[model samples]
Target: MNDITVFPTIDDIMAAHQRIQPFIHRTPILTSEAINQIAGCEIYFKCENFQKVGAFKARGAANAVMKLTEEQKVNGVATHSSGNHAAALARAASVAGIKSYIVMPSNAPEIKKKAVAGYGGEIIECEPTLIARETTLKEVVARTGAVFIPPYDYLDVIEGQATCALEMWEEGIPFDTVMAPVGGGGLLSGTALTSKYISPKTNVIAGEPEGADDASRSFKAKELIPMVGPKTIADGLLTSLGKINFEIIMEYVDDILTVSEAEIIEAMRLVYERMKIIIEPSCAVPLAALLKNKERFKGQKVGIILSGGNVDLGKLPF
Candidate 1:
């Protein structure tokens, strides 16, 4: 891989912040004194759940679409996602007055599908597998000549994701540790890079579900270990980490903590009950890790990214 793809600079992130500011929501950072007392840590939640398209994926998608060349924009954009990013890219493309082709899993939630279509995305369903998703996306790109805005691996997307952390640094109080869930590792990689660049003393932590713990294994082994048939309630987190994300993670991430299915559910429930906000299972993983290992965060200031609120209430896990 090229150096530019592997190492995204702070300037790239700052540029993305400016580029996407007009298109995406500047989601607020929230804190709960009640929950802080329980966890024994002062916790700040960057509420990306309130972001456009109900996920932090909006930041990356908006940046990617906005950065497209005029010629490329005319041909439109395409991407494959099980959920959030599909809707996000669709929304970004629509806002930019271009078409969006979204290849989604056949088994993706109805709510997500509706969001993609509602934002004017043309949907093509594929089997719920990495190979199938990639194959189907190739077909869509070939047929439409659309620029493929990958969900995580692309440099522009990573830089856009980093803007979330940059905002945390600019808006919130100082934090000793910043945590986010690891799916394809987009958010985690961006968080790690931003933390290292802006707050060198801050440690970046990743929270991954036990059923999809390839990231944890890869971090420990210092190699990429892809996940196969990961069965977790956090549907958004089933994908393996990307190569660029892995590179950034290896250099900047402090540690990865894995949580069980029950712990994830408990965390989700606790956040809803105490914080009075909705978060998808994937968003709850980081808090689950903190709850499981409270001693590590005791007396420390921590930041957690609530990645999305795009949950299908009809198919509730609890």
Candidate 2:
């Protein structure tokens, strides 16, 4: 739609890097020689789990919020997110010294809800559905006239998400494939754009959980396959890709793969045990895909984006 909304090109992503550098953390790349030797692939991990708000969503949120016009800033901002985006927007709003209204699914994790409030944003609980989230956001926007900062539907946000890839490219290491978990496809779209331009030879892959492979379907069908709602172990990847992201992903992404709940759980345990890093199920999907498709990456350098570390131990099914 609308020529795929050419968002944050490599230049734009680099600018986002500069714009958010003062605010965001350049999360470390965690590596495990042990796993590498066993898996037969050199892996470089962009641990966005170490990022502020515990996810790369903060990068996009912060950039979009900061770009608001003075008038728009004065009116405030609003958004709908299940978790990471909510925390990110709330944090970004606080940094920008503006009021933020976050509408979240009623069933969203309590920890995520609390993060939104902790960042000084007002929260409104909606039905556990995107329709409700959008309805509430529209009402808030119409009433307060706040700028609506979309989660993954906006260009600025996409560019900011791509910055993670831009930063990863700094090592001058060429990857055979760059794999990122897909939810709303914000991260995948950004990663694909960055990889295509920065490392033209690299294949960009989008990882999704089985029973929730909307992006895969969309890519293969070459049309937007909107999932009203999806069920998946990776909560972060429960939504279908956005229209803009679908276009980019369909055209540029090499493949959209799926992993099972068992694979994700094992991946999570592996990361926690071997890498000594905590990651949510959503963040583990990419790694799970890599583990499952080892044959494809055996001799190539692969980059995986561990999207976030925001997991509640008590709620986990151990």
Candidate 3:
């Protein structure tokens, strides 16, 4: 059994929030009566779309960058990401006055590439496979002697992510469950840790694309199952769950739910139409899962983390 207690505590999350306060956005929480009626539940949507870099990844990246040693900061930072985290880490490094090296999949959305460059990141493009991305990142780190801040899978990153849940808990509305889409599992694990410490009675749930449901599979099998070529329109969710993230989630998270691609598109459309806010497909997974199983959440108060808004407008599935 994994030692769940070894994970960062609520105090760590509080510290991260304080550290990144000046650099990050305290995004708002939105409530929609129409969405509430449709799901038959009270839902609080944390609008991370309005966040710095237009995603909650800013929270984790900023915290990580801020916690770096002077030596590490001087050496700069590097990471492999195809979406929000790439831009977020780049932006955070720029704000901290450090160089950022990014290894991005060549097939990654053009919008993401532009965003990373806009943040002053040096982009090294690799083939769209995980192997290629990792290999390219290794080369970049070797050449630049830069510290690699992974998109997820690090304690600092996870603790930083926990601040989102900590803020949600501070909102004073008691939630029966809190949900977020799982990709590499940083946000979900952080959310789980926060719920465990701050709202022990609250259930933590993860939503995953059915095509990339490794986290849900791992949860059911009681072991980590790394994904291989999982195909999903939710580009942000294509990565496998990290080992640390899986252990923490297995110990504290209540459930992992999977939703279809069509379901994701519809949920994204719902948010765009009803809330008048743009959300990426990954952000829609939690809502899709909830609506798909409305009976399970009827009459309950649920908190959801809208992970990002960095979608390619021209390539929208809807």
Q: In candidate 3, where is summed lDDT lowest over 10 consecutive residues?
A: 1-10
Cα misplacement distance, residue 134 of candidate 1 (Å): 2.0
Model 2 agreement with the true structure over 214-279: per-residue lDDT tens digits: 888888888888876588778888876888788778767999889999988988888888898888
Residues 93-152, model 3: lDDT tens digits: 999999999999888878889999999999999998878999999999999999999888
- Every candidate's lDDT: 0.92, 0.87, 0.92
**What would the TM-scores of all predictions be?**
0.96, 0.96, 0.96
CA shift at 292, candidate 2, in angstroms?
Answer: 1.4
What's every prediction's RMSD, in angstroms?
1.5, 1.5, 1.8
TM-score of 2: 0.96
Checking candidate 1 for backbone clashes, the offending pairs are none
Q: Which 10-residue span in candidate 1 carries the lowest summed lDDT?
A: 1-10
Candidate 3 ranges with C-alpha deviation above 4 Å: 1-5
Clashing pairs in 3: none
